[model samples]
Target: MRRTPADVWLALPQPFLASEALAAGRTYDQLRAACHRGDLTKLAPALYAVHREWADLTPAEAHRALCRAAVSSLDQVALSHLSAAVFLGLPHPAGRLGKVSLTALRSTRTSYPDDWRRVLQADMPESHLTSHDGMQVTEGSRTVVDCFRQLRLRHALAIADAAAGRGLTTPVALQAMRQFQAGWPGVLSAERGIPLVDGLRESWLESASVAVAHELGYPLPASQVWIHAPDGELVGRVDVLWFEWGVVGEADGMAKYLGAYDDDPSPTAAGQRVLLERNRERRLEGLGFAVARWGAADLRGGGDGLARHVQEARRRARPEQIRCLWRQDLKDPLQEWVWPPPTRA
Candidate 1:
């Protein structure tokens, strides 16, 4: 039995290729009719997608679709910058970013870059190249440092911390790349943001929040510290610990507590998660630490938004009451976990 356009459209992937559709039993006339009827949107020469589904995607998702198109269109090109970050699974700030990005040993078209793609001209070493699925891509550390040089401080730190946190790369390697690429466009921003990365941060939200804290000139806090009761009972592992100030800053994402409440996103599940958090806060406060939580709204507020919430906790915390119950495995941030060979690594 032959498949019709409707059948093939649903069967094919989002942002699929003209050839993919034709291969999947769509005739040339049907592909054109679909395009004419607004059933498909052309992303590039041969790349296309279901129009309605494409419209519903967020910026990041849309970019991933574009990256996939680039993967299909180019032959032997290394995906670079944010496009490389996408394939590497590194987190980036939310927003519409520019064209699909790639790297070539040298530019193929001397006249112009493709309307939808940015091809970086470079002679990057083989060591700095890797692959995603089958498409050539810059390696993790190289991708990250590339982004750091291209993006601003807030966006760069999030990517850097995520790369470090996941064991994909180390701050030391990032710094070395910055020095090697010195005087290249935007290298100074990379150099500045590289020092602020802490691999212990578990999420992009936590990393970005700390980046803002740096700009606000707030005291830098310890990342991922464990607090124990004097009796040796583990109270909790915290996101950010101002050890001396007795402050515990928690970066609460929208879904942090939802999954544990049975993956049920109902109001009841939300309430249960809040109850559990409240209970945890009471216990941490019992240990003389004032616990504060910040969310995306706080980060979005800008100015003194997240800062106010954490600083308020600081006001309530008693440094004199701070105790040795919190056991921090990494006392020094610059121990540079991935560089020094983790005792366990």
Candidate 2:
């Protein structure tokens, strides 16, 4: 029987056991052959999902299916590391994925971890454990710390920033969570990177761009800044502002241009977005700001080139005809930026 698109879409939600399939009139040999031939995916020892439908899922959604399929087979294990981070909706690199991350509660024994094929293990206390629809998972802060300790500095900073940006966790709490994995090789990155995270960053690329800019030895720039005209008219909320240098930097990701945030993903919509952005940039220039915009490709090669580009833009900056808001706390890291500025600095 030929399956239609609707059939696959409907089957997506029904992750099932091999026993269930056998009971539903599917032969064991047919199931085994389908899995071996890539027609189906075995999410756990006995759990299965349609391979085509599984591939259609976003990384987080796919991991969720993987977890639900495996949850009953594995006991005393809470989702940890990247698995828990994505499950809790933390900032993750788009389209990036890994196997289900789990940590044993009482002792280290598991079906997947025992085989060492599709699961990674960490050790966490029961206190850090939480439940999601009766399935064990790590708390947000603990998951952030676990993910941060394992990911690269730029990648880790995004998770940290999202956690802080939404008030999911604080720096102090992350510091406390670090103790669980203390003295391990990867813990140092989490410690060094946590303090550098800013809640004001609005995207993974923005967070990554800041990390790259910092690595290039430039002082951290104020982010999520609102620029105003001389007559008190609103110009725009710019991404990066170095008030002293009059350099305004923008990280232009595909989501900004490709209508990822809106219902339309058409090229016409993208072109319209670009035109609107150009108009916005002209307004900022009217306010006497030099704008530096870069996308992921510009910074992919370790940002040496992006640094030079920004420095060149800095050189083009004109004398401030209209004052732009810098983080009053930029010079003082201890004082946090209270989301909306009380008054211009």
* TM-score for all models, in order of appearance: 0.84, 0.80
Which residue pairs come into collision in candidate 2?
none
Q: What tens-digit string does per-residue lDDT give for candidate 2 at 115-166?
A: 4224445666677888887788888788788777888777788888887888
Question: Model 2: how far is 96 from its true place, Å?
Answer: 4.7
Candidate 1's residue-wise lDDT over 66-168, tens digit each? 8877767666677889888876778877888778888875546421566788877755888888767777788878888888888766677788888887888
In model 1, the runs with Cα more than 4 Å from the true position are 1-4, 8-13, 17-30, 44-46, 52-58, 108-114, 260-266, 301-303, 329-345
TM-score of model 1 vs. true structure: 0.84
Worst 10 residues of 2 by lDDT: 332-341
Instruction: Give residue 61's error in model 1 in angstroms.
Output: 3.6
